[model samples]
Target: MIKITFIEHNGTQHEVEAQEGSTVMEAAVMNGVPGIEASCGGACACATCHVYVDPAWKETTGSPEVMEEDMLDLAYEIRDESRLSCQLRVTPAFNGLVVRVPEFQA
Candidate 1:
């Protein structure tokens, strides 16, 4: 299992375990991490799962796909680190991955 930490806007942190092939959104929803609405169910059709990739793990998490980027424009508080959790696949390098959930979703 890969370990991923999600920090809420209010600073609440949720550490979750994920399968290598799952997306970040799946892990959050499966583990009941607060603030991840996942409205489109990892279809990349919505931005409710918006999150900020921790700068430290930016390279490992990488950037969003063009489709995801289009949806991210609907998210609140866009930032360079902003990403749609549905687009990030968990991998061994993401064992310590960290992301931040915004206070609001699209």
Candidate 2:
């Protein structure tokens, strides 16, 4: 399992273990991490699962695809680090990934 940490807007932190091939949104939802609404599930059709990837892990997460970027435009408070958690697939390289949930998401 890959370990990931989610920091909520209120500074709450949730550490979760995710299986390979699963999306970051899946892990958060399964672990009941607050702030990840995942309203569209993992379809990348919505921005409810938005998160800010820590700079140290940004390279591993990579840039969003065009479709995801378009959806992100609907997310509140988007930043260079903003990402749709549903679009981030888990891999060994993401074992220590840390993301922050925005205020609007919480």
Candidate 3:
């Protein structure tokens, strides 16, 4: 399992473990983490699962693909660190990854 930490805009933190191959969004939803709506259910069609990869883990999380980037364009308060959690597949390297959820999502 891969462990990931999610920090809400208000600074609430949720740490959860998820099976490898599962998306970060799935982990958040399964663990009842607040702020991730996952409206498209990991389909990469909605921006509600958006998160900001911690600068230290940004390289490890990698960059989003064209499709995800396009979708992220619709996310609220998009930033250079912005990413759609549904597109981030979990891996052993993500054991301590940290992400920040926006206050509001589109």
Instruction: Identify the leading candidate in terms of lDDT.
Output: 2
TM-score of each: 0.98, 0.97, 0.97
Candidate 1 structure, TM-score to reference = 0.98
Across 2-34, the per-residue lDDT of candidate 2 in tens digits comes to: 999999999989999999999999999999998
Better of 1 and 2 by lDDT: 2
lDDT of 3 by residue, 1-106 (tens): 7889999999999989989999999999999999899998999888999999999999999999999999998999999999999999999999999999999999
Candidate 3 lands at a TM-score of 0.97
| lDDT (Cα) of model 1 | 0.93
lDDT of 3 at 69: 94
Model 3 lDDT, residue 74, Cα: 92
Q: Which stretches of candidate 3 lie over 4 Å from their true place?
A: none
